[model samples]
Target: MPYITVKMLEGRTEEQKRNLVEKVTDAVSETTGAPKEKVVVFIEEMSKNHYGIAGKRVSDQ
Candidate 1:
């Protein structure tokens, strides 16, 4: 069982998240030779304030 975790700033449409998971699963499966059914993906979305860049929070940008 291969587990993949994706972390990004919160605020993506449902369709976008769906497509992201599907594409990521396909890529992992293709490269690792893991069955699609056995591939696991976790989406972790955080608020802009929870993420930062250049010592500044994304929410501030």
Candidate 2:
């Protein structure tokens, strides 16, 4: 089995997340020889205020 974890700022549409999971699971299955059913994908969405870049909060960008 292959497990994938994705972390990003919150606000993606449901369709976007679904597509991302589908694509990532397919890629993992293709590259790692894992069954599509055995590939687990997790998405963690955080508030922009909780994430930062270049010494500034993402919400400030």
Candidate 3:
């Protein structure tokens, strides 16, 4: 089985998240020779206040 994790900022529609998971699963399966059913993709979302860049929090920008 192949496990993949995608971390990004919060705020995405259900349809978008569905598409993202589908595409990511396909890519992982194709690259690792894992069956589609055996490929796992995890989506982790964080709020702007929880994310930071260049010494500044996203929420403050």
Residue 1 in candidate 2, Cα distance off native in Å? 1.2
Best lDDT goes to which candidate?
Answer: 1
Question: In candidate 3, how many Å is residue 42 off?
Answer: 0.6
In the range 1-61, model 1's lDDT, one tens digit per residue, is: 8999999889999999999999999999999999999999999999998888999999999
* lDDT agreement of model 2 with the native: 0.94
Q: Candidate 2 on 1-61: residue-level lDDT in tens?
A: 7789999889999999999999999999999899999999999999999999999998999
Candidate 3: Cα lDDT at 3 = 86
Model 2 has how many clashing residue pairs?
A: 0
- Mark the 10 consecutive residues where model 1 has the least summed lDDT: 44-53
Model 3's TM-score against the true structure: 0.95
For every model shown, the clashing-pair count is 0, 0, 0
Off by over 4 Å in 2: none
Please give the CA lDDT of all the candidate structures.
0.96, 0.94, 0.94
Candidate 3 local lDDT, 27-54, one digit each (tens) = 9888888999999899999999999999
Clashing pairs in model 1? none
